[model samples]
Target: MAKKKRFLKMKIATLIMIAVMLVITGCSQSSGTSVKDGSNESKSSSGTLKIGFILSQTGTFAPLSEGIINGFKLYLEKHDGMLGGKKVEIKVEDDEANPQVALRKYRQLIHSEKVDILVGPISSSVVYALRDEVEKDKIVLIDANAAGDDLSWSKKSDYVYRISFSNWQNGSSAAKYLANNVGKTAVVLAPDYPAGKEVLRAFKDAFEAAGGKVVKELYPKLNTNDFAPYLQQASAENPDLIYAFFTGSDGIRFVTQYKEFGLKGQIPLAGTLEFGDELITQPAGEAAEGIITGINYSPYLDNELNKQFVQAYEEKYGKLPNIFSVQGYDSAAIIDKAVTEAGSANSEDLIKVLKGISFDSPRGPITIDPATNNPIQNFYIAKNKLKDGGIVPEVIETVENVTMPETSPFE
Candidate 1:
């Protein structure tokens, strides 16, 4: 009986010891730890900067997302796979241009992967959905392509900063130039979505303010397979010009159908940046020719920085870089700059450094407006002219230092 009791006690002691050892091992494998010197500073276990991208890799926004990812990877390739002088680990999730899917990916990125920075989603709808979540999670999101105007206004969050142009900038940038050069009366068209509505509204306000009139406004459902009906409606209006905003496959189809419907030369076709970008023009071919647009970046820009960028991009990808590509490249550039300046990957540290950050971009010198958290950059009034067997934007006029207002002009 005495030997049995002693053996049982020894077994219990061994089990307890094993349990304590397992707990210690688990703690050592945990995410991070605070400084032992009584300071509140915390550090990650691996000391690697982790970035998560939620992009539309398999939907309408795929091309745009591809450009963004390509540009980001190019930057990494040039910098030895590092950002802010620290090695970067990137995890990309396909949001499929859907908001709910983006939310789920966001959770995985934040909780499971523990990424330090967040980027992307080509859809403005997805950006709107992510705005609240990033704020709640206290993660810094660098907006690569979503351009909804409300992101800089009513729905703005300190946690979110846009590297792409806003709908307001997109719509209004060419309004005055087109109103003066193209015609005084125009028909405006965009898909019936938040970005579409905001863009048309901006164009309308600016065009009217510049003494021009919008004769009619057309809102077609997104991804309209045929723009023949809208083209007919705009043609029937007999306006001086037609201004439209469409992107991705929609942009390609609209430009092609606009020419097929015989409204290309009869009524001047003017549109936002996407109309002038190579993504649409290369595929649309002759149909995209002679269109006037307001563009933020083009491979044809005359500058040493842009020339180098074009050469490097072509050498690597065997293709020309578009505005979406510039947005992606600048997205990585801003992160590298911010992280370096902040000296920490924490959201709090990055936010402080990102405000009013300025850098020389392939587009031109770009500054983040401290007030609106939107980019203050240049807009080019360009006309698509065929050269070298391809359509390229010919700069007609340069609008410099185009800035977004701190408050919504609509409000």
Candidate 2:
């Protein structure tokens, strides 16, 4: 009986040693990687402030998201990666341009990663999907590149703030320009999404108010590859001008196909910022030339800060910064300002600090509107021109203080 007891004790000690070895190996692996959707990319630093960045790393929105990340990092680089004298730690996630994936990434950023501030996944739909959750959790979400109108009005949360253009600003500004400068008869087309529909409505209201007629309004299904049929319908109307809002790959395909349909300059073309996005303009080549649009920023804007920003961006990213990057840069600037003013990571304090703050952005002087919590800044009516070097947005007119009214969303 004694001999049997000794053998059993030896076997028990051996099993205990193996279990501890497995645990130690597991710890090493966990420490080496991050807690994401099995992603290996990570950017961590020692700090009191943790900023979680959620944007696309794959799929259609990748280019725009890449620019946004670059811009955000550029600002931090200049500021020594320290915001408001607090060591800033950044956690980035790849949303893959999927709303469901975005939610999962967001939860990790909030609960698992424990980020103090959260900034974007550049899609209006994605932002809306995560909106209610953020409000319920009482987290700070600075709208970087998502320009949905609801973010300003109906579905707004007090904890939410926007540093980018609202759909109304883009549509109304372009509509006013088209009526006064372009033509009296117009046909507009856009992808059938919330942003697209809002653009259509805002444009219609402003154009009609200015004594212009919208002969036809077409909403193609989102992610449409073929714009030939839509272009034909607009041409059949025999309109004096054409306006559109196609984003991502759709934008690229529309501009390229519009020229192929031989309607390039015959009717004259104008749109919101998407029509002149660098991702579309450069890829669409001559098709993008002479396209008139309205936007908050253009790389060619004449300002000391803008010039410096463009130069540094080109050097670092090997490409011209577009509206996405400019908005991303501004988002970082806003966060810095709020954190510095509040001197704490408290959500209530940060929201108060952001409500009425003003700053001189690369685009121009901007302030957070207390009523709508959107940027009250200039919107530019620009024309795309292909120079010997490259195609760029040329500022023709500047509309100052373009913002949403306190009570808006008229039918």
Candidate 3:
């Protein structure tokens, strides 16, 4: 009887030891830490909520993406590196401005990294390519920069949201400005893509609606470096004004070539807000003066919020915040608001909160359209001016708050 009791006690002791070992193993996994039985030492564990950022960090969209990332980081820093009381981890993947690469990186971010949220791929093509994949994964994708109208209209998805103004929105305002203010006989040039096509269409529709005419239209290849031929064609057209939609370095090249061809003052130039900011203003110097563009946000915007944002941005980056930066910053703010309102980090909950959510922006109050998941906001008409030997864009007029027209083809 004594021997049997002793054996039973030993068995119970062994079972307790095994149970403790199992608990330790489980804790290691849940805590995101590795443990080694041989060392008999437990390492401190840390938890992070991973956020995937896919952008053109090294390619054509680099300049824009860099601004987006900077704005996002600035918001994260202001929030003290925590979102909804969870430590935030930003994992960056360079798409190199290629749609295929962006798609691959997105898959990796979802399947491999298991990120909680995903943002970016600054090119419209990249955004379109991965939209389906992001929907399938049920992840929230906040587009900070891409402005293709199709994403907000025909290809709209519940999971995808855009904080920036669409190319069509800018195009519509540009058309209004040209028809009502500048008056008819305009030559239009944009890249051969959905965004460019949509901008041209909006401009034409609005211009013609206002009793104006598009004298000539040109579609340039996205990578074309030479604008000489295009400029010569535009000059031959002898339109009252020249309207363009080139972005990034292409914008610089186009305007520089326009000056070279002596079309600068002979014919006034106007375009989407992409051309109005520091990117073109500072770099193009005197050449950017007198150019008009439609904008969503300007550092010179007369709002208390904008005033603070511009001051903080200049103090940190030593430059004025561009539209991209404002959009990116607002994107982070929207996400933060959604997370707080939802009271959870769950993607679906956050998404529900995001729908119809409105926030005060540098551009003004912007609301996410439930049907399209895009922002409905105001557009600005601005002119580039040479101030203090630096090119600065001053807002000439506010076009007032314009919503997406019901007749918009994409819708």
lDDT per residue for candidate 3 within 247-274, as digits (tens), equals 8888888878888788888999999888
Q: Which stretches of candidate 2 lie over 4 Å from their true place?
A: 1-46
Kindly report which residue pairs in candidate 1 clash with one another. none
Write the number of the candidate with greater lDDT, choosing between 2 and 3: 2
Error of 1 at 319 (Å): 0.7
Please name the candidate that would achieve the greatest lDDT relative to the true structure. 1
Please report, in order, the local distance difference test score of every candidate based on alpha carbons. Answer: 0.90, 0.84, 0.79
Candidate 1 lDDT by residue in tens digits, 1-411: 999999999999999999999999888766263222321123332567888899999867789988998899888888999889788889999998889999999988887777888889788999999998887877889999999888988888888999999999999999998878879999999999888998999999999999899999999998799888888899998999999999999999999999899888899999999999989999999999999999999999999999998898999999999988988899999999998998888788889999999999999999999999999999999999988899989999999999998898787
lDDT of 2 by residue, 1-411 (tens): 999999999999999999999999998766533434322122222336778888877766787788788888888888888777777788889887678999999999977886778888688888888888788777789888777888878888878888887888888987877898889999999988778888888888899899899999999997788888999999999998999988778899999998999998898999998777787898888889999998788788899999999898998889888888888888899998997898766576788888989998888999999888889999889999989857888888888998787767584
Instruction: Tell me how far the alpha carbon of residue 38 in candidate 1 is from the true structure, in angstroms, after superposition.
Output: 20
Query: lDDT score of model 2?
Result: 0.84
TM-score of every prediction relative to native? 0.94, 0.87, 0.89
Q: Lowest-lDDT window of 10 residues in candidate 1? A: 34-43
